[model samples]
Target: MAEVSAEARIEAPAEKVWAQLTDFTAYGEWNATHTSFPNGGPDTLETGATFVENMKLMGFPAEVTWTVEELETTRVLAIRGKGPMGVNVGTRYALAADGAATTVRIDGEFTGAAVSLMAGKLKDSATAALNESLRKLAGLVT
Candidate 1:
């Protein structure tokens, strides 16, 4: 299994950051690994809702079918998915309000036979992607 995480502080309130984060239609604009949502983003932001996303990581393209596992307006969003080669992927976006600004953290995990073979490289790539994604997200709201 491979796990990666990144955190950043944005010069905007939690609500502002949450708005941009949940705006799935604009997801690829800032999410580094995102390619596109083939059938469009999820129609609802509730637990159990599912969506399909196309993404690129480690120079390879993949399609994932994701189910929302958790949701809390302006605070958290978590999803788990099945990716190519039977890889299981999980991601969580958490937000904390701090006065006039907000701190955001993204945590991701990968597990499956394929991951065991390239865990190190996957960790490095995923960590970088998360950081880049956070930077772009901050740019949009801050």
Candidate 2:
């Protein structure tokens, strides 16, 4: 299995950050990596909720069916999904209060053939994308 994690501290309250992050319908508004996410909208965020997300990764269009695996009000959200790559991918978002800011962390992992062949490259790309998304989220919340 290959794992990739990235974190950022935003100058915003945890509630504000959580609201923006969990609002699935508006993901395309600030998430640079997502081109379109026309699935269950914001209502499809509870545990076991399923949706399809269309994203551009490394300039390629990729679509994945994702299910919310876990959710905790303003602290954590985790999603798991699979695509044609045959990998079970897990994406997690964690939030913590830091003084007057909110620290957000994103972690992802791939457990299948596609990631084993390109683990290093995938890790690098995931890190960069996570950082970019954090920057955009910060801008949106602040």
Candidate 3:
């Protein structure tokens, strides 16, 4: 299993950050891992919602069917999905508010038979992607 996380402090309120973070229409613009949602982003972000997403990881394009695991309007959104080669992936977006700024954190996990083969490379690349995603999210909301 491999786990990675990245964080950023955005000069904006949690409401603003969460709004952009969950904005499906503009998700591809700031979401590094997302290439496209074939049917479009989820109509709703509530728990139990499912969506199919096209993504690039480890230099390969994959289609993942994800289910919303958790949701808190301005606090957190987490999803779990199955990826290519029987890999189980989970990602969480966490938001913390302090005065006028929001602290955003992205957490990722990969598990299953395939993850052991390239854990190191996956960790490195995933960390970079998480950081880059945070940067893009910050740019959009702040």
Candidate 4:
């Protein structure tokens, strides 16, 4: 398994950050790995809602079927998905409000047989993607 995380302090309120984070229509603007949502974004942003997302990582494209696992307004959102080659993917977005700023953290995990073959590279790529995503997200909200 591979685990990666990135955190950034955005100069905006949690609500503002959360709004941009959940705006799937604009996801590609900030999410580095995102390519498109083939069937549109999740119909609803609640637990058990499912969506199909197309993504590119390390020059390879993949489609993932994701199910929202948890949701906490303006605080946390977590999803688990099945990716190409039997890889299991999980991502969690956590927000902590601090006065006028919000600290956002993204945690991701990759598992299954495919991950074992290139765990190091996957971790590095994923970490970079998360960091870039956060930077773009901050640009939009702050």
Candidate 5:
């Protein structure tokens, strides 16, 4: 298994940050790993809601089937998914409101036979992607 996390403090309220985070239509503009959402971002982001997303990791394109496992408006959102080669992936976005700013943390994990083979490199790539994503997200909202 491989785990990666990144965080940023954005100069915007949690409401504004959450609004941009949940807006699938604008995701590609800020999300580093997101290449496209073939079925479009979920219309309703709730538990059990499922969607397919096209992504690029380590320069390889992959299709991931994701299900929303948890959602709390302006606070938290988590998703678990399956990708190629029997890989299992989980991602969690947590937000904390401090006065007028929002602190966002992204946590990601991967577990599978394939993941074990490239865990180190995957961790490095994912960490960088998460950091870049947070930077872009901050730019968009703040």
Candidate 6:
């Protein structure tokens, strides 16, 4: 298993950040990592809400089937997914509010036969990608 985490402070309120982050249906509009996502959005951020997303990782096209594993409004959101290349992954988003600013933290893990072989590179790439995504998200919400 390999774990990676990244954090960023956005110049936006917690409500604004939460709205953007939970709106997974429109992820392709702001998130550069996702090329395509399912049209049907999750009913709510609760365990069992399901969806699929097509994204690019390490310059490779990947599609993942995901289900919400845990969620708490404006606080925590976690999703687990599986994909090709023997991938099992989970992503958690944690948010904290400081008056007008919001701090967003992303923690992700990948565990599988192939992941063990490329854990180091995958971790680095995932960190970079999360940072870039946060920057882009800040622009969209703020």
Q: Write the per-residue lDDT of candidate 5 for residues 1-142, one digit (tens) a residue.
A: 9999999999999999999999999999899999999989887899999999999999999999999999999999999999999999999999999899999999999999999999999999999999999999999998
lDDT of 3 by residue, 1-142 (tens): 9999999999999999999998898999898878999998888789999999999977879898899999988999999999889998999999999889999999999998989999999999899989999999999988
Against the true structure, whose lDDT is highest?
A: 4
Off by over 4 Å in 3: none
Better of 2 and 6 by lDDT: 6
How large is the C-alpha RMSD of every model relative to the true structure? 0.5, 1.4, 0.7, 0.4, 0.5, 1.4
lDDT of 4 by residue, 62-121 (tens): 999999999999999999999999999999999999999999999999999999999999
- lDDT of each candidate versus the true structure: 0.97, 0.84, 0.92, 0.98, 0.96, 0.86
Model 4 residue 111 distance off true place after TM-score fit, in angstroms: 0.4
lDDT of 4 at 133: 100
Worst 10 residues of 2 by lDDT: 36-45
- The list of candidate 6 runs beyond 4 A from truth reads none
Which clashing pairs does model 5 show? none
Candidate 5, residue 35: the lDDT equals: 94
Cα distance off (Å), candidate 2, residue 78:
0.3
Q: Where does candidate 4 have its weakest 10-residue lDDT segment?
A: 38-47
lDDT per residue, candidate 6, 80-104, as tens digits?
Answer: 9998978998999899998899999
Candidate 2 residue runs with Cα over 4 Å from true position: none
- Ten-residue segment with the worst summed lDDT in candidate 5? 39-48
Candidate 1 local lDDT, 75-116, one digit each (tens): 999999999999999999999999999999999999999999
For each predicted model, how many residue pairs clash, with residues at least 3 apart or on different chains?
Answer: 0, 0, 0, 0, 0, 0
lDDT of 1 at 86: 92
